[model samples]
Target: MTPIRHNGSGSGSDNDHVLDAVRDCVLAVGVRRTTLADVARRAGVSRMTLYRRWPDLRSLVGDLMTREWIDVATRAMAEPAPGTATRTRIVDGLVAGVGAFRAHPLFRKIVDVDPELLLPYVLDRRGASQEALLALLADALREGHADGSVRPGHTERQARVLLLTVQSFALSLRTMTDEDDPELDSAALLGELRTLLERTLTP
Candidate 1:
């Protein structure tokens, strides 16, 4: 279920421009309406340049998601705070990953504009972003398990479950009925999510 990331060109600038174009186009007119020509126009690049990087819109979007999520996971792991317990680190990392998905503008745009576009990545195959996230989780879960701070299940399986939970809430919150929505404050949301994660890792 691992999805490959489509590396842009030799220059980081091309990737940035192309990804920026895709994000701008999606925000402006949704994924379905976004085209290579439009992306090129927005990026001030020729269609040839865009094609050289991505065969189509789907490929571009996949890589864009990967880059963004990699940034999210990288940032989360960078600061572990002194003396953080392994299980606590797992919870914190999960919450941080969820926050990234929640706070990302492009993610929000996709959720609001074309939610269906997110289904494949969620239900079927694990794309580059999913793999990146899972790897990060796996590393943390292994550390937790080794220290006897986490549950006894396979680290990869536990990571997958945590990832699914995070993705579900991050992507499907809009589907909640008005009365069903918790409407909790930020602290409450993460606190509840952390509790749920903690129970699975504890006796």
Candidate 2:
């Protein structure tokens, strides 16, 4: 991610403060209703200060989503059980990431309030966050190959397919969920996802 700038200097904490303000604004009124002025006010910074970093609300919100999503993915990838095989680690991390993203407030707001914002990333092109995630998945797959756990293949290709499968689960699982039917509920479907990944990656 590009470093966020403020007052002729760049700082991570400063960037987070700005994104936090953006998050609050979007959560309250959503993307269409949110304004740079409101974000500036909430961030306790001048509007020009925000403009220097982000020309418009869309770019700012894009960066905020990148940060939030990457954080979720990072946390998910970090928590596999001790001594887990590389393929198991990758599958577990991805499954956990699907759940985390589904539960994230910012993701929920965007899906509920401005779902079209996601259409470009889904149909047209990969966004920064998606690229980051692909890189992470590819690296883990390389490790799986080294350990003889994942099937042998082009790492990037394998990672892309893995991401495609996980994205379906993350984005569309809710539509398939049956709350009243334990046999086809979210948790049960996720178990199926776990099994699918295990089979896909096994050497």
lDDT of 1 by residue, 1-203 (tens): 12576665648876887888888888888888889899989999899888887878888887777777788767766455567768887777777877776788877887778777778776777777788788888988887777788887887888889988877767654454243445655545666788898898884
Q: Against the hidden reference, what TM-scores do the models get?
A: 0.84, 0.93
Quote the positional error of residue 194 for candidate 2 in Å: 0.7
Residue 122, candidate 1: alpha-carbon lDDT: 68
Overall lDDT per candidate, in order of appearance: 0.77, 0.88
The residue-by-residue lDDT of candidate 2 on 36-134, one tens digit each, is 999999999999898887777888898898899999999999644557888988988999999999999999998899998888877878888888999
Model 1, backbone clash pairs (residues 3+ apart or across chains), number: 0
**TM-score, prediction 2:** 0.93
Deviation (Å) of 14 in candidate 2: 1.1
